[model samples]
Target: MFDQRKQDSLAAWHKLATQAQQWMDPEQQYDELLKAADEMEEKGLITSSEWRQLVRDAGSVFTGSQEHKTH
Candidate 1:
């Protein structure tokens, strides 16, 4: 009975780990960051100009534009 329960726990752990790995995908992370930025803008945490800059920077990160990337 103990061995069976251990096996079940291990299987469940593997499933959760797999899901976590998938959830950390780079594109997914970028989208999530954009959504968070939107929420911040809605909450008035940042100005309109700042939000625009955030979107532009995020796009540059994925698109690999050196102009936007450099200081």
Candidate 2:
């Protein structure tokens, strides 16, 4: 029961993570995500480490901004 619950939780996490990754686009999505993170940090809703991890995950999804061209 406990093990099953743990597995379920992990699966849910993965699904959410994947859905988040798919939203990286148009720059606005990243901007909105960062804004939310900033608000969360300001409100003490999330730790610095958590914010950093979110930024890293967002970076992985978007790679770079449109202003910057990758060679």
Candidate 3:
């Protein structure tokens, strides 16, 4: 029925919104950013120089003197 489909769509949207909210959390944001950086490096999206700069910039945002430790 139309009503049922609408309800299902709403539920799916709500779940996605919740997931988006979780991804917005600070820790999650950091993790996701690191993942993206790693992926970029692996896919050759950024040169080593660019990646180092990105890491330095991102490290500055975090607390502690340790630099961003990439795998």
lDDT of each: 0.54, 0.57, 0.49
**Which segments of candidate 2 are over 4 A away from where they belong?**
1-24, 64-71
lDDT string for model 3 (1-71, tens) is: 65575455445433433353444644554455455556556766566776676555445433222243332
Please give me the total number of clashing residue pairs in predicted model 3. 0
Candidate 2 lDDT by residue in tens digits, 1-71: 65575455445433544555455553655665566666656766567997787667656545544344355
Model 1, 1-71: lDDT tens per residue? Answer: 65575455444433433343345654654565577557656766667887787667556544543342464
Please give the range of 10 consecutive residues that has the lowest summed lDDT in model 3: 62-71
For candidate 1, report its TM-score: 0.52
Each candidate's number of clashing pairs is: 0, 0, 0
TM-score of each: 0.52, 0.52, 0.47
Please name the candidate that would achieve the greatest lDDT relative to the true structure: 2
lDDT of 3: 0.49
